[model samples]
Target chain A: MIKDIMLISELGELALIEKIRGYFSIGDSGVLIAIGDDAAVFSADKKNIVTTSDLMSEGVHFDYTYTTFYQVGFRLVISNVSDIYAMGAVPSYLFLNMALTGKRSEEEFDDFLKGVREACEHYNAKVLGGDLSLSIKGDFYSATLIGFADRVKTRSGAKPGHNIFITGNTGDSAAGLAYLKYVKKRIPMEKNMEYTSREIDGTILDTVRRHLIPCACNPETFIDKIKAMIDISDGLLLDLYRICAESRAGALIYRDNIPVSDGVRAIASMLEMDYMDFVLSGGEDYELIITSDSDHLDDCILIGKIIKDGFFFVDSDGIREKFVPKGYTHF
Target chain B: MIKDIMLISELGELALIEKIRGYFSIGDSGVLIAIGDDAAVFSADKKNIVTTSDLMSEGVHFDYTYTTFYQVGFRLVISNVSDIYAMGAVPSYLFLNMALTGKRSEEEFDDFLKGVREACEHYNAKVLGGDLSLSIKGDFYSATLIGFADRVKTRSGAKPGHNIFITGNTGDSAAGLAYLKYVKKRIPMEKNMEYTSREIDGTILDTVRRHLIPCACNPETFIDKIKAMIDISDGLLLDLYRICAESRAGALIYRDNIPVSDGVRAIASMLEMDYMDFVLSGGEDYELIITSDSDHLDDCILIGKIIKDGFFFVDSDGIREKFVPKGYTHF
Candidate 1:
C-alpha cells in the first residue's frame, strides 16, 4: 500500500460522502443532526449569527504547482474563519463544497479532508456537512462558516480621532508568494532562505508558512474594546479604506509605525521589488485591523488615526502623501 | 442599450460584487448585516437552524448546450431551498459562491443574478454574503442555505407500519431531460410534445418547465403528521432506500401505486425507453416523500408502505421483486 493511488473515479459519490462523514463525525452537543442527513441541524442561541462564505479556485487562487492539497483545504478554512473572527464571533459550524478535477488519488483526497478536519478541530469547530462534485478542469473549494457573536463589530463605528490599529506584521505572505514564484517550489526557511545579508527574526520560511498555512488571529481578548474591526485580508491600505468608506471617515497612516518583517524586506530587495508594495498592499495576512477611541488596546499596535475626510500617510522622513489601495484585485 | 454587452472582464471584482449586493439588498429585518461587509450578520433566534450546501458544476453537472443562465441560477437556489424545506424549515438566508469563465455579457450575468434573486424572494430568503472568483475552466456555482425550524423532521423517524407518502408526479423531470437531449436543443412542446398518440394532461412543456425551473413541493400541510421526511433529489427507489437505511426498516413500494404521467409514458415509448426507468430511477424530481401513520393525509399521494425487514415492490400483476436503487450517480 506504499504506492496507493485511490482515484476518485474508482469510487461512487455515496462512498466519497460516506468517507467524508467518517472523517468529520460530529462531537458537538449543539449539533442535533450532522453529516449523512439532508441538512445539518444545530441549536441556535439568541445571539448575532455571523455567516461568511469564501471561494478559492485552483490556477486562479492557489497554484497546484507548488501547493499541497492539504494546504489548500486548510487555507480555505483559515480564510473563512478569519472573516467570522473579525465579526467578533466564535466560529462554530462549517459547510464545504468542493469540485475536483484531474486524476487525484484517494489518499490525496483524504489529505485534503484531513487538512480541513485538522483546521476545524484546531478552531474547536465542527464540520457539519459538505457537497462534492467533479470538475472539468482545476479544483475549486468553497466554505460557509457560521458563528455566534454577542456583539458584532462591523467595519463601521470609526470616527475622527479614533486610532486605527492592526495586529501582527504584514508583507510576510506577499513576500513568501514572491519567493515561491521565484524559486518555483517550496523552500526551507532555516538555511539561508533569506536572500539579504541582513538578519531578521522572521525568515522566508516563516513568510512562506504564513502564506500557505497561516493561522487566523482570534480577537477574543480585545474584541470588546474595538469600535470597528476587519481582517487584513486584502492588504492594510485596502482594508483600512474599507473601514473608512463604511464609517464615512478617512485614515492617516504613520509610515514609521507601519510594521514589515525584515525577512520580507530582504526578499523584496533581493527580488528587485518595493518592500512597501508587500507591506502596505500585500494581502492574505489574516491579521485583525481594529479601530478604537483610545490607543490603549492590548496586543494590538497603533498604526494610524481616523481623519476628517481624506486618506494620507506620513513617512519616516516626515513627508505626507495621498495613499491609495493597490492590492491584488481579481477581475 | 440594445447592443449592450457588459463583460465581467471589463468590470472589476469589486464592481461585480457591488452589483450583486445591490440586486440582493437586505429587506429582512432579522438580518443585522447583509452584503458589503466581511460577512453577513443575522440575529439568531431560539430555534433549530437547518443548514445545507449544494454544488452545481458546469460541464459535469450541467451542459450549456441548451440551458439558460437564468435557469441555472434559478435551479441552484431551488435545489438548496428544497433541502431546507425537507427539514420542515422556512428557508431564511442564502450564501452563494460563483466562479465565472469565458465571455459573459452584463445582461447575461444580470439575468443569472436576477434568477437567483427571484427564486430567493419567492421563498422569502435573503442572499447574504458571496465570494466571486475567476475560473480557468467552466463556470461553477455553490449555494449554502440556512433556515430555522421549530421542529425538524429527519428521515430517521419512520416506523414499520407508517404509510409512505410523496408529493407530485415522478418521471416528469427525467422524461423532459430525455426530450431535451433527443431534440438537441430546447423545444416548444405545445404541439405534439407528447411523443405518442396516447393523450395525457401533462405536455412536454410542463415536464420541461418542471425539469428546467422546478418548484419543490412544500410539505407544510402534512409535515406535522409525517413521522419522517426526505426530498427526492435522487430517484424514488434510491431515496426510499435512504429512508429505510436510516430508519432501520424496509419498504414496500406499490408499483401500481407509483404514479407516472401518461405524457412520460408516451414519450418513453416513442424514445424506445421504459416508462418505469424514468418513473422509478429518475433524479431531480424535487418531490417530498414522507412516512406517516394516517392514510387520510391531504395533498399527499400514498406510494408505498414501510415493511419490517426486506425491501420489495408489488407490481400490477401482484408479483413482488426486490427493489434496488439505480439513479444518476456522480463519482
Candidate 2:
C-alpha cells in the first residue's frame, strides 16, 4: 500500500506553533502582552492565583486505539480545569504544550487545537502562549491552568464530621472505556462536534461516548462551602482516600448511596463484570469529590461522612467492611 | 549480564512524585497556598507577571549518548529561566513535569532532580509542584516558570536608532554541541555540582561543557537601560530578525564586533570549519540580545545597531551586505 501522508517533520516546529497560534486569536484572549517575545508578559489584578499543570502522554495516559486527538485535547483541558476548580478558583488562562511524533499529520494537529479551543470556550478560559515540540515517539499533551480566587481551599481542611459529597455519577467514563476497548474504533456520538453532549442509550452510545470523550465537570456552584476538595481522576475510592490522608481523617461510604450511571451497569452486565469495580476503582471520572459540613448543600450528592481514622464501606444490605484503594497508577 | 536497576515504572507515578517532592522543601515557598489540593495556590503582589514554559524531549531535544540526566535537568531549568529573564522578570517559582519510560532507572531520575535543584537554587527560584506521568517511549521534561516584575521589557520596543547589545559571547554553546556530538560521551564539567562554571580549555573542556550544560545569562544588570530584549535561543541573525520584524525595524551588524568565544574559534579552526557559521546561526547560546538608546552600557558587548529597514551585515573589512536568517527549528 502506498501512503502519501504529510508528516510534521516536513513542516518544521515554528510552522506547527504558528498553526496552533492561529487557532486562538491571542489579542482578544489577553495573552498578547509581549506577543513576539521569549516569554509571555501580562498583568494580574487578583489577590491570589491558583496554578496547576498535567501531562498526558500517548499510550500511557491515552491510546489512539479508541480515541482521537480532538478528544484527547479536550480531556486534557478539563483535567487541568478540574484541578483549579477543586481549589475553589475560577479557571481563567490555559497554556498548552504538545510533543508529537514527527510522523503525525497536520490534520491531527488541527483537530487537537480545535478540541482545545472548544473546551476553552466552554469554560470561558483564554488560551495563552505555549510550546510545540517534537517527540521521538507517541504524542504528549500538557496543559497548565492559571485561575484566580479570593479564598483557596485545600484537601487538608476536612474535619472528622464533614459530609463526603460527589458532584456527579462515578464510573461512567470508565464504563465507556470498557466498551471502546472492545469495539476498538471511533464510535461517533454526534455527527457534529458541539460543547454539549448528546443524550444516548446506556447499552452502547453513552458508555462509549463517555469513555472516549468524557467531559470534566465544574464545581463552581458549591465551591465556597467545600472544606476539602479533589477531582476524581484516579477513581472515586482512591481520590477520596487521598483527601482523607491529607486531611488526617478517614471516610465511610455507603455503596447504595454512590451515584452511578446506567451506562456502567449496562457495560458491566454485558461484559460479565462487577459494576462496583468500575464504580470504586476505574479512573478518569473527573468529578469533584468534596467534604462539607452543610447538610442542605445544592448540586452535590451525599454518599458518606468523614471518619476519625478508618476507611470503611457499606453495602446495600447494611454490611460494613474495611476496603483498600486500588486505582490506575502510572510510572 | 543481569541488570538490577530499579525502574520508575516499578516505583509508580505517585511514588515518583513523592520522591521529587522530597527534593524540595516546599512549605517555605509561596506555592504551598493549598498544599495537597488539585492545584497550587499562592499570592503575587507584583503588578506584572511573566510566565514561560518549554518542553525538552529525548532524542529530539537531547540525546543520552552525549549528556547525563544531571546536565539535561540543569539545562532544562536554565532554558526556561532564560526566557523569563529575557522578559526582565525575576524568576520566582518553577514547576517541573516529567514523563518517563518504564525502563528509566531511579538513579537517572535522582540525578536529573539534583540538576534541577542546583539550577533552581542558582536562580533563586523555588520548586513548587508538577505532574509525573508515564511515556511509552523516551523521557520528556517540561518546566513552567512564574516570575514577577514591576515593569516589563519586550522585543517590540526597539526602534531604528537603538544600539544592539549581547550579554556575553555567542556561539559558545553551539560550538560545544558540535564537540559533544563528535565525542559522543558524557564529559565531566565539574567534580561537585556547584552553581559556578569551572574554567576550562577552548579546544575540549569549555566547549564540551558549554554544549553538555550551559548557563543562561540574567540581563538584570543592564535591563533597565534596554528598550527591547530577547534571548538568543536561535542563531544571532534569526533572533535579530525577529526583533526587527516585531519592532518594525532592521539591524546592521559588524563581523568583528559580534563576540565569538575562544572555544568556538578553536573548535572551528581545529575541525577546518567556518567559525562564522556558528557565530551567525548557532542555536542555544542562551545569551540575552537587547537594544538600548544609551551610548554606553556596562556588562554588555555592543554588537550591532538597529537599522532603518533591512538586515545588513558589515564584514571585518568594512564591506556591507544584506543577510538571511537561519536558526534551529524543531517539528
What are the clash counts of all predictions, listed in order? Answer: 2, 2
Cα miss at B94, model 2 (Å)? 1.0
The iRMS of model 2 comes to 17.3
Clashing pairs in 2: A13-B330, A176-A207
Off by over 4 Å in 2: A1-46, A188-203, B1-46, B190-203
Highest lDDT, which number? 1
lDDT of 2 at B276: 86
Candidate 1 chain A, poorest ten consecutive residues by summed lDDT: A188-197
Choose the strongest candidate by DockQ: 1
Model 1, range A207-299, lDDT digits (tens) per residue?
777887888899898777888888888788878887887789998899898888878888898899999999988889899889998768887
Estimate, for each residue in A78-163, the C-alpha lDDT of model 2 and write its tens digit: 88887777777778766667777766654566567767777777776765546667677778888777777766777778899999
State residue B54's C-alpha deviation in candidate 2, in Å: 0.2
Q: In model 1, how large is the Cα lDDT of residue B61?
A: 64
Clash pairs, candidate 1, are A6-A106, B6-B106
How does chain A of every candidate compare to the true chain A by TM-score?
0.81, 0.82
